[model samples]
Target: EEVTEGEEVERKEHLKTQWARLEAVVGTKARITLIARDLVKHFENRLAALDGKAMVVCMSRRICVELYHEIAKLRPAWAAEADGEGRMKIVMTGSATDPLDWQPHIRNKLRREALAQRFRDPGNPFQIAIVRDMWLTGFDAPSLHTLYVDKPMRGHGLMQAIARVNRVFKD
Candidate 1:
């Protein structure tokens, strides 16, 4: 069932309208932004007490970027230069054509692996990672004490994500 260009545009506009209505019924962007700011502050205190890192899982790449920027505004220390050293970073899969892809943190296998390694190192500056769907499995970070999940998950996916914070780190 191939649709005409006009039909596709109509469908997209319909979806956008529906999405806007849904957002109004559930939560507004301003409310979410305020909560994200508070969540960063809350987690900062908790993570500091535990002497551990954290991972924040978002539902979409767009939300990941949005939350990162919001939190960065509150905690300027968490904002890292795309090419320089920083403790906080966003990890999401993106292709070369994706305009939102950060040059230093583009989501390739090699870059993902490198970021994971840094996240796992307690002495390293990379303390927090914001992710959408990456590092849900086979990635280990014993020092990761908390996982803030803004996205929904169930069954195996849910279990694997929970396991991320269950590892024991020798202090």
Candidate 2:
């Protein structure tokens, strides 16, 4: 569908006019820094209420790294600088050959499975997981009660993402 300037204008005006008649849904367009801030706040609140973990889905690895740093700043205990033992949060993305200083947590398939297991474990404090395209589907975590989506997802992909938290747990 080639949308001309005039047609685009008309479409926008029509949508604007019908805005009140239709339910409005605001999508994500915020800066990564700001989104990270809100994500932490949501996690803190959910922890208090449900005592569960949270997952953050980003559009790209770059944004995932950016959000990880931002959230790390707010929650020092989750940052790599906090301790040598481990961090509370982990970034799970596809492995890269040329390693970057910011993405120490990027893992291979086997290691990714390990991290996914840790995230699923209730005993572990690995609370928040930041991902680009990994773990949105076929990964089960019953303790994960919160998901902050910073990317657009639809259809089966969206359903699978929601299924991550829609598991039955004894807790």
Candidate 3:
């Protein structure tokens, strides 16, 4: 699907609006932003605060490149933080390939310290790109409270997705 430049912009705008609505219902301190090209900045500024804090970066295979690039930039800084004691930590889940398995341009591969994941069911799932990813369901991160969603999603998936940020933390 060759979505024209115009179409992609429209989709981003639409997602931004929806996110504003989801923000109200999501718990305090929890937020979702629709950052098109600035995904890296958002991650460094918002998600980075959780670095070395025991968290999961759940996202679709499609955007993993952007995620990877961003994390690569921040690795040095986090390496100093001392995760869970004396280690730097970051857990990512996605298929062995790319996040957007549909896009041939986005090639996924094992890079640096990041690990890959393959959800049991493949194409059988109703693919609503805006929402498909491994970090969405049944995943827990006690230190996770804010989620930055750069993609789209709806219905049960939407609810379960952000809910990943709801786990309680101690001290």
Give the candidate number with the greatest TM-score: 1
What lDDT tens digits, residue by residue, belong to model 3 across residues 18-69? 6556443441222222232253455456644553122233233333433333
Q: Write the per-residue lDDT of candidate 1 for residues 1-171, one digit (tens) a residue.
A: 111223677787786666556545434468658867778787879966778888888766666776777777777887876523676888877777666434445656776777888888888878878887788787888888888887657677889999999877876
Score candidate 3 by TM-score against the native.
Answer: 0.39
> Using Cα atoms with residue i matched to residue i, what is each candidate's TM-score against the true structure?
0.77, 0.73, 0.39
Superposed by TM-score, candidate 1 places the C-alpha of residue 93 at a distance from the truth, in angstroms, of 1.3
Q: Give the TM-score of candidate 1.
A: 0.77
**Backbone-clash count (model 3):** 5
Scored against the true structure, residue 10 in model 3 reaches a CA lDDT of 76
Question: TM-score of model 2 relative to the true fold?
Answer: 0.73
Q: Give the worst 10-residue stretch by lDDT in candidate 1.
A: 1-10
For each candidate, what is the lDDT?
A: 0.74, 0.67, 0.38
- For candidate 1, the lDDT comes to 0.74
What is residue 108's positional error in candidate 1, in angstroms?
Answer: 2.6
Tell me which residue pairs clash in candidate 1.
Answer: none
Give the number of the best model, judged by lDDT: 1
